[model samples]
Target chain A: MIYLRLFWEFFKTGLFAVGGGMATLPFLYDISDRTGWFTHSQLADMVAVSESTPGPIGVNMATYVGFLTGGQAGGMAAGVLGAAVATIGLVTPSIIVILMISAFLQRFRDNRYVNGAFYGLRPASTGMILAAGVLVVKAAFLPDGLSAFDWRLPVLAAVLLALTNLVKPTKKLHPIVFIFASAAVGILLELSQ
Target chain B: MKELLSLFSTFAKVGVMTFGGGYAMLPILQREVVENKGWATEEELADYFAIGQCTPGVIAVNTATFIGRKQSGIAGGIAATLGIVFPSLVIISLLAGVITQFSELTWVKNAFAGIRVCVCVLIFNAVWKLGQKSVVDRWTAGIFAIVAAGAILTKISPVAFVLFAAVCGIVLQTLLKKGGVGQ
Candidate 1:
């Protein structure tokens, strides 16, 4: 039953979570809230592990969830199915549309409305992407079980934002550098206390 | 072939180094695949990105498959896929041990916190820039707003959202076609 539930949940997550793996946060959170499949902390750990690992963070997480719920096979099942569902979910519709339109692509290829529609899609996708970031931020910093949301992280986030935009010099800085530098600074601060 | 091996290796390097997710992988992928190997042109890479966006897997994986298929045919596609997945497996395995062991380390914990926040910022920036290309008119802007609202209100599955976007594009295009504006 657990395995079936895992498969279904992941299948659903894969079916809908778009923009990328992080976009699945709300679904994962919902799953956690509804089922005791894993704790909120586990979800966070999954994010860390997923981010630190490879392939896709969301896929990595599905595998992690499967593994935690069942074991090796469970993990593999969840991972593969989650990936499959998500991939299929993401692709299936587009594939149908492309196939349907392939014959007429040339006819409407230069159509303004077609072009305009794509133009619209870009920002809409961007919005989804932005929403994904916010949801993840909420999950990452505050989490569900928190006694209180961490004020420092938000303040830190604002600092990072100002530093990125206003500082100008830091705007083009490699993300990894910011990642490591911030980490180092965070550690140093932790150690100082 | 050795060429296939090289393709595998380069994408593997990309797969290994990328920490966050799709957006994080973009710069490195562009640097290595587009800039370094010259295997794919910028336009081709952009096309791959669109296809990747429409595909059913990680954009990086879908991209590898597309590029590999383009470069070396079926075998090339397999090689590229292998290359991309390799780093992820190794990195995750190595990290599993290190993270498990160091899970409680203050420095490690803090560092993760720091990286997580940075990932958020990077995601925002990427979306912001990408939005510049996407929201070109009121109609598109309306699409953007509608999709954004749906995403926030429901946190709908990405698949549904993408599908919704695709339908919206198709319908708009069809209507425009009916109006004979393109002629």
Candidate 2:
């Protein structure tokens, strides 16, 4: 049942999550909320892991969530199987859609209706991604309540934002480097405290 | 057999080297699939990328599937997909197994705390970039505003939002065409 549920959940994610890896965030957040299979905190970790590692972030997250859920359901063996199932579930839609597109590539590409739909989807997907970002911000900075607000974390986030954006030299640096550097900063902050 | 093997290996290399996200895979995919393997031309790869964007699921997987299917057949599509995700499955499973075990530790928790904030920033950055590209006109800006607000305010499924948006898009386009206004 767990494996079946895993497949079903990820199948929905794979099928409906148009756009790219980041676009899957809302679905993943929904999955976390609905299933309790993973926490928001854990979702952030998965994002970190997915982003820093090779491969598509969406696929990485599906595998990570599946592995964790399956491990809890059975053991490491189930975990591996769950990872495969979830990953396949994630990509199954792409395979099916691509196969269909390949058969009628010209017509599909030239269809004005398809283009218009995409034109609409582009902004809508961006909105969803923005909403997902807001959710992450809430989860990370306001998990408990506003009363327990931590200023240092926000400062760290701002610094990272600036480093990745406004800063000249650091702007072009890969995100993995920032993630690793943040990890070290986190550990050091903990040590200081 | 040889064709499928090459398809798998080529995509496997793509899978392993792709860092960040699907967009990050573009250059590597260009090199492997176009320049080296000659599976797809530059324009063909661009088409795949465009289609992959609007299609469901991961763009990288979609592109790989397209290239694979083009090369061999449906079997090649499966091979390429499997190859692309194979690295993710193995690598994520291993990391998840190890991370779950260590997540309880203080250092790990703190590290996650910092990483979580960093992730928020990254997601925000992505939104900024996506918004720049997608929210080009008044209609799209309207869609973005409404969807953003609705998504945050309501617990409605994201799937519903996407479907509704697609329908709205088609309808709006029809209306514009009837009105003789250009998109």
Candidate 3:
């Protein structure tokens, strides 16, 4: 039953959450709210881990959620099965749709109508991604709505640091370096407090 | 048979190298599929990316499917898709076991908190980079604003917005084409 539910829920997410991995955040949040399979904080943790590790964020999240939910029922085997199911469910739509596109796109590849459609789609997907970014900020910084200790300062600093990598010597470093650096800073700050 | 194996291995390599998402994976994809393998030209890969973004799925997987199908066939598509997702499945399953068991620990908890904050920045950075590529003109800017606002304000499904935007693109571009705007 858990495996079935896992497949169904993630299938629904895959079917709808258009754009990319970040676009799936809203649906994942909804799943957390509805199923109680995970918490908002856990969702945040998933994003962190997914971003730090290799592979697509959406796929990583599906596997993580599946393992967490399924680990509760049986054991490691169940958890692995759950992950496979959820991950497959999440990508099933992608596989089907891309296959369809590949089949038909050859004839229409140069058609202006098709080009026009993509022109419209590009900005729209960008908007959706931006909306996803906003949601991530809200989930990470204000999970309980507004509070006394505003976390925006560190967020801004983090943005600057990430952006700084675009300019000079730091630009060549791998993103994992940034991820681990932040983790170290977090532990240091928490222990100091 | 051997070609299919190579397709699978190539995508598996791409999957393992991808961090963040599809955008971050572009350079490596170009290196593997374009420069090294000659499976696709640089231009064709860009086209695939554009098509991949509009479709309903992770762009990374979509692009892999595109390249795989181009190289072999539907079987190749499945092979590539499976290859791309396989790494994620293995890594996340392993991490989930460890994370679930130790998430309550003080140090792990704090590290997650910090990671969450950094995630906000990373996502925002994606938006900035994607917007630069996507929002080219006034019309696109308008589309970006309207779709963003509509998504936040309404209960409409994200699919509806994408469909609407597609329609808008067809209409607006057709009109612009007729009017000789970018011709």
Candidate 1 reference-contact recovery = 0.37
lDDT of 2 by residue, A73-171 (tens): 888899999999888888888899899888776458678787677677778877866776676687667756788787888899889989989999998
TM-score of chain A of each: 0.51, 0.58, 0.61
Q: Between candidates 1 and 3, which one is better according to lDDT?
A: 3
Where in model 2 is the C-alpha error above 4 Å? A1-90, A101-106, A191-193, B1-80, B92-99, B178-183
Model 3 over residues A52-117: C-alpha lDDT tens digits? 677999888998998888888889998899899998899888889988988887768789888887
**Across residues B1-183, which tens digit of lDDT does each residue of candidate 2 receive?**
999999998888888876556755655665577667889865465446556756899988998999899888899999999999999988887777566555457776676666667767876775675577677789989988988899899977666777777777888888888888653
Error of 3 at B33 (Å): 8.4
> Positional deviation of A177 in candidate 2, in angstroms?
1.8
**lDDT leader:** 2
Question: How much lDDT does candidate 3 score?
Answer: 0.76
lDDT of 1 by residue, A1-193 (tens): 5556676776677555544566678888998899776799878877766754545675556555555555333444444443333333333332333333432434686877656455445656666657666775765576534676666777677887777667878866655566677677667665212
Highest DockQ: give the candidate number: 3
- How much does each candidate deviate from the true structure in C-alpha RMSD? 6.8, 6.9, 5.5
Off by over 4 Å in 3: A1-82, A148-166, A191-193, B1-64, B67-73, B95-99, B181-183
Tell me the TM-score of each prediction against the true structure.
Answer: 0.65, 0.64, 0.70
TM-score of 3: 0.70
Share of true Cα-Cα contacts across chains kept by each model: 0.37, 0.75, 0.69
B1-183: candidate 3 lDDT, tens digit per residue? 898899999899888877556665665675578768999865466456556656788888888889889889999998888899999988887778566445556776555556556555655654565677678899989988998898777767667777788889899998988889656
Q: Residue B71 error for model 3, in Å?
A: 5.8
